[model samples]
Structure formats: C-alpha cells, structure tokens
Target: MMTVNEVSRLTGVSIRALHYYDQIGLLPATGHTDSGYRLYDDTALEHLQQILLFRELEFSLKDIQRILSNSAFDREKALKQQIELLKLKRQHIEDLIALAEKTQTTGGTIMDFTAFDTQKIKDYAAQAKQQWGATPEYKEFEQKTALKTEKEVSAMGGQLMEIIAAFGKMQSMDPAAPAVQAQVKKLQDFISEHYYTCSKTILGQLGQLYTAGGAFTQNINAAGGPGTAEFASKAIEVYCRTAK
Candidate 1:
C-alpha cells in the first residue's frame, strides 16, 4: 500500500488534486491507516493509470468517470484505444517539430500552417470516446436525461437509491427467495422506467457493476449499509437466472 503523498510524488499529481479526486469519487483510496492517512493498493494505482491516460487525451473528469463507471467498459479495449490516440498525438507533435525545423532552415519563409492542424487527432479521439463511452444504454440515458431538469434528475437518482436501500432490510434472507427476487425485479423495472430498457442481460451486468467496488458500490452501500450491494447483486443474479 502506498500513501497519498507517495502517490502524489510518483504520479506527479498534487496532493490537493488527489484529495479532490477522492472527494469526487473519481479515484478513491483503497483504505486508510489508523493514523488517518490514505493508502492505495495496486488496484487503485491501476485505476489511477487509466485516469491519467484519459487526462492525457484531454478527456474531462466527468467523461472519464462516466466511461470508467460504465458496466460495459472493457479495460483492454480502452487501453488499446488510448494507445492509438497517444500514437496519433505523438505523430502530431512530430509533424509540428518537422514544420518548425523546415521553417527555421528556410529562415521563416514557409507560410504553410497545415502542420498545425490537429483535426485528425481530435477526430480520432472523439471517435474513440464515442466507441467506449456512448453505449446504447448511455445514449438512451442521455436522451432521457436531456429532457429533465437537474432537480428532477437528482430526485430520480434518490428514488433509485431508495429502492436499493430497501434490499438492505432483507440481507439475512436467502438471495433466491421470492421476496428478494421480487425486489430485484422492482429495481430492474425502476431502471427501465426511468433510465433505459433494463433487460435481463443488462440487469445482470448492472448487478455485477453494483458490487464491483467503486462509486456505484460505495453509493449503494452508503444507501443500504455495508454489504447491501453484494446482497443485491446476488439477488439480481438469481432473478436473472430464474427469468432465463
């Protein structure tokens, strides 16, 4: 485990920014020591690596969180896309360097500004973001959310958490019990009605995401108390299997 200061030095990110990232739920520390110092495990470091790469690509923090939180997110695929985008950025820099060298040789005679065009890099980065971030459900979510006032959206999110919190009350029951399954169904229907179509497949994926131990899990557990997310996931798994 590495301390926050250690991470700040290693990543060249300021301690203030690291705290801000933690505050926003963008990159939570793995744990805290008895003395209240933040500690990060290898998994947290890996997550930080992804965040830094997205930052290098000039992705907004909100966009980065949305992309990483996506249940459909594939780490390997995103890494590959980031690699391509970085290569393009490197090529763009090299082109600019060559242009500068040529202009220097010609004593500033070259008036061509084509080498400064970054449209290609911008286009590729935009395409990559769309590929990884704009899943079908996300698109649908965007459409639905675009019509709502901020207050309305916030209310909807609270309502959804209320539903998940209800699961905490039944944590002691068998996850496959009819009551638990019914609750899972209710949660699924709530998502379908408000956000996007929550088909069994999608619901199953969401179940996994809820317990995958990040912001979703954190928020869910916060609403329902500890282990609530895991219980809900198991109940969802059973519901999906029985529906199948």
Candidate 2:
C-alpha cells in the first residue's frame, strides 16, 4: 500500500488531482490507514496509469472514468495499447524531424523528390533488410516469401483487408467474445503469413496504427464508420491478454 503522497510522488500526479479523481469517482483510493489516510494498492496504481495514459491522449476525464469503470476493463492490455500509441506518436515526430532536415537543405520547398535519390532509397532498403533479417519475424517472412510472386503477395493483401472488413462488421461485439478473438487471431496469422511474424507486441502496435492517420485510418473508418479503428484496437487488446 502506498500513501497518497507516495503515489503522487511516484506518478508525478499532483495531490490535488488525486483528490479530485477520488472526488469524481475516477481514481478512488483502494483503502485507508488507521488515521484515515488514503492508501493505494496495485489495482489503484494500475487504474491511475490508465487514467494518465488517457489524459496524455487527450481523453476527457469523464470518458476515462467511463472506460475504466467498464466491466470489461483490462489493465494489462490497456497499458500495452497506450505504450504502443505513444511509441507510434514518437516515431511520427521523428519522421517529421527527418523531413524537416531535408526541407532545410532544399530551401523549404518540400516538393523536391530529388532528395530521395534512387541509390539512397535502395541503400536504405538494403540496410533495413540487413538489420531486420536477424529478427525471428523477418527471417520467417523472408523464408515464406522467398518463392512467392508479387501477384500472390498482392492477393494475400486483399484477403487481409477482407478480414479487416469483418472486424468492422463486428465492431459492436465485446472484444473478448470468441468471434472477435478468432478474427484477431486471423489478423495475427495473416500478418505472419504475408509480412512478418505478428508477435503480440507488434500486433498491439498495429492496433494503435489502425488510427494513426493517413489512408489507413480513412479506409478503416470507411469500412465500418468512425470509431471502427478503436473497436479493432480494443479487440486486439483482448486478444493479446487471452491468446495462448
């Protein structure tokens, strides 16, 4: 058990915020001491983590409370999802920084494709392949695709999209439902078959990416309407927790 001050110090959340959270039924203290001092247990700490993550993602306190109070709230899965989303956001920022450097060298026109020279692109590809070839996922992908043609790869891609559409259809279902879990498993396997071994960590990262903007999010939203990506991400959360 940790005192309120301890939790505040550990999480960098202000004492006032903690009191407000408890006041609002958001992050209630798990227990109390002999002098009636608030104390937090592991579960309370976990809830606080979720609350912080949602706040970082700009979710309103009301929504975070609702989500955390939900019967199906899964702490481990939620933590993984938050970490993945933050990492993706960080990566996007890094990419923007790289592009900014390129822009500086080209007088900020930002329209010059010449910066991406053919040899540079090829070299990058070679370097990526060399680095990733050592990973189990990449080795499996390389071995599986060694004899596959471009046509077959494209066909597999279409099938994966079909499964994504199916996910949209079942967006309203509880993510822990067997039906939803099956689709998540299919998604994992399909990725492993076509691209790389879809480890749970990577799969969770992709779940976050489903709404990471660009055509991917647009297409997913078009498939099942807005919030479909969130449904898929939650489904992935369930899958990671319960998968064998």
Candidate 3:
C-alpha cells in the first residue's frame, strides 16, 4: 500500500490533484489506515499509472475516467491509440514548421493553405487497409477516380451548381422541407463519391466552410448568390441527423 503523498512524489503529480481525483470518485481510496489516512493498493497504483498516461495524451479527466472504467479497456489497445495520436501530433507540428519555412523563402507568394488541410494522405491509406484489407481494391478505386478527365470533373461541378441553384430558388421555402433535405443528401453523397471519405465531423466542418469565407465560400456564393451556403449548411445538418 502507498500513501497519497508517496504516490504524488513517485508519479510527479500534485498531492492536491490526487485528493481531487479521490473526491471525484475517479481514484477512490483503496482503504484507510488505522489512523484514517487514505492508502492505495497495487491495483490503485496501476489505475493511477493509466490515468497519468491518459493525462500525458491530453485526454480530459472525464474521458479518461470513462475509458478506464470501461470493461473492454485493454492496455495494448490504449497504448496503440496513444502512440498513433502522438505521432499525428508530431506530424502536425512538423508540417507547421515546414509551412513556416516555406513562408520565409516564398516572399509571401506561396500560401500555406496546405496547413489547413487536416486530412493526411497516410490516414486515408490506413483507413483503406482497415476497411478493404491489403488488397488492390483501394488502388483500383484510386485509378478509376484518377482516370476521370477534366470534362468529368466539370460535370460533377455542374451537378453541384444545379443543386446550389435549386437551393437559391427555395430560399423562401421552409428550411425543413423534404425537397431541401433531399438536395442535402444528394450533395453529401456527391462529396462522398468524389471527395475524401465523408465522416460526420468532416461533413460538418466542410458545411461550415461554405459560409466560413475564403475561396471555397466565394466560389459557392458566386455560383448561387449569398445565403446559398448557409442554407446548404442547415439542410446538410438535417440530412446528417436523419441519415445517421
């Protein structure tokens, strides 16, 4: 058994933090000494180690508690997830450094908009492997998509413009109407097919981009007029909820 102070000294975590953890029921006292001092057994020590590891990974205490209390918690899985997350963070920092160096040499001519692209090609490869195995399915899909000519890309863009035009025509209609919702689904499906994988997080972010300004918003608005993008965002949100 170890005293709270001993655990604090050993783990380099503050004693007050240990007390707060106990108060929150995240790290309850294992037992009480004869004089009523809190004591932690080996199991509690192990729990502390896990908690500290999660803290190092920048997980909120609540998130860590939920993870630690889950019956399916696996040390190996947790370590693997942490390692991936840390590697991503390191890569993000490196990208930022590279972008800064580019800015220094380009005399502000070359933009660092590439940094805003949070999605990495390696992540797509990993997802492909996990979903379709180590086969050539992903490669085939990539080849087919790449074979698309300028005309094909323009045709897809035309389809999006048509959707935007319809949205503009329905500007005065109820935002919850089935017609608008249908357009939203069509847009999402189009994105999933032509763009990267369309997760809810990514979709929501892209929807925001339509009205968030910058070249993307400018292009969308120029096609269908102002408020086109905002309406699309609302309609897309509704579609996402129903589709899910």
Candidate 4:
C-alpha cells in the first residue's frame, strides 16, 4: 500500500485534489493505516489512471464519476476512445501551429479564421459521451439530477449511505434472513424512486461495486464500520437470487 502523499507525487495530482476526490466519492483510498493515514493499492492506482485519462479529455469530475461508476464500464473500450480523442486534439493543435507559422510568414496580415474551428473535436467528444452514457438508467439519472441542487444531491447520497449503514448493524444476522432481504428491497426501491430503475441485474452489479475496494466500499465502511460493505454485498446477492 502506498501513502496518499506518495500517490500524489507519483501521479502529479495535488494532495488536496486527491482529498477532494475522496470526499466526492471518486478515487477513494483502498484502505487506511492503523495510524489513520490513507493507503492505496494497485487496483486503486489503476482506477486513478483511468480518471486521469478522462481528465485529459476535459471531462468534468461529475461526468467522470458517472462514467466510471457504471457497472457496464469497459476500460479497454474507454482507452481506445480516449486515444482517438487525443489524436484528434493533437491534430487540432498541429493545425493551429501551422496557421500561426503561416500568418507569421505573411506579416501577420492573414484574416483567415478557419483554423480556429473546433467543431470536429467538440462533436466527437459529444458523441463519445453520449455513447458511454446511453443506458436507460443513466438517462433517467441525468434527467432526475438535472433539476436538483448540489446540496440536495449530497443529502440524497447521505440517506443512501445511512441505509447501507443499517446493514452494518445487522452483520451478526444471516444475510439471507428476511430482515436483510427487506433492507435490500428498500435499497432497490430507493434507487428506482430517486435515481433510476434498479432492476435485479443492476442491483446485483451495485452489490459487487459496494465491495470492489474503491470509494464505494470505503464510504460504506466509513459509514457502517469495517466489513459492512461485504455484508451488504452478500445480502444483496441473496436478495437477487431469491427474488428471481
């Protein structure tokens, strides 16, 4: 495990930015040391690499989180898209450089502004974003959240965590118990009501994400204590299996 500072130095990301990412449920540390220092494992580092790639493409943090959090996200496919976008960006820059040189040679009197056009890059990016976020659930989430204030969204997140935390308190009980299954149903209902329609398949995917050792796991553990995320994941698994 590497310290947060070490990660910051390695990735050239600011310590403050990393902390903010943690706060916003982006790139959470894989675990914490006994002394309360944040620690990241190789998996977390790989996630960070993906985030940085999206950042390089000028994606907003919110968009990056949404894209990465999707259970269907494909890292290799995303990498290919990022490479294509970067090549376009590089070509744009080269065009601008050539324009600048030509203008300089012509005594800076050229009035042509065609080189300033960036419609191609912008259109490609828009198309890529649409492709990545085209799921019905994602569309519903976007529509629902488009009207909410940031504070309201944060409150909703807190409420969801509270439900997960409840699972932590029931860790001693059988995960397949009726009570645990009810809680899983409640979680699914909450997601369907507020964010998107949470089908059994989606719920199962979320269960995996809850214990996938990233911000979701860290935040759930922070709220409910250690091992809570795993317990909830188990409960979810049981719920999905029985409900089907």
lDDT of 1 by residue, 1-244 (tens): 9999999999999999887776555676667789988888787788899999999999877568768878767889999989998998898899889988998888867888888888998998888778765668878877888788654665676677789878999999999988988899899889998889999999998889899875568656655768889999999998998875
Best by TM-score: 4
lDDT of 4 by residue, 19-83 (tens): 87766556766778999888888878888999998999898776787778766677888899899
lDDT of 2: 0.68
lDDT of 2 at 180: 91
Q: How would the candidate models be sorted by TM-score, starting from the highest? A: 4, 1, 2, 3
Which tens-of-lDDT digit does each residue in 1-244 have in candidate 3?
8998888889898889887766554576666679977777777787788778767656656446535533334667777766776677677778888888888888685654776565763564344223322324334435545777544544554565566546766778776798887777777666677644566766666677666643334435445667777888777676666666
Which portions of model 2 show Cα errors greater than 4 Å?
A: 1-136
TM-score (C-alpha) between model 2 and the true structure: 0.45
User: Candidate 1 versus the native: TM-score?
Assistant: 0.73
Model 1 worst lDDT run, 10 consecutive residues: 149-158
In candidate 4, stretches whose alpha carbon ends up further than 4 angstroms from where it belongs are 149-162, 165-169, 208-230, 241-244
Per-residue lDDT tens digits for candidate 2, residues 11-82, read 999999887766444565666789977888776786687778878755556445434533344567666656
User: Which sequence of candidate numbers ranks them by lDDT, best first?
Assistant: 4, 1, 2, 3
Among these predicted structures, which one has the highest lDDT?
Answer: 4
CA displacement after TM-score superposition, residue 208 of candidate 4 (Å): 5.2
Which should have the higher TM-score, number 2 or number 3? 2
Please give the clash total of every predicted structure, in order: 0, 0, 0, 0
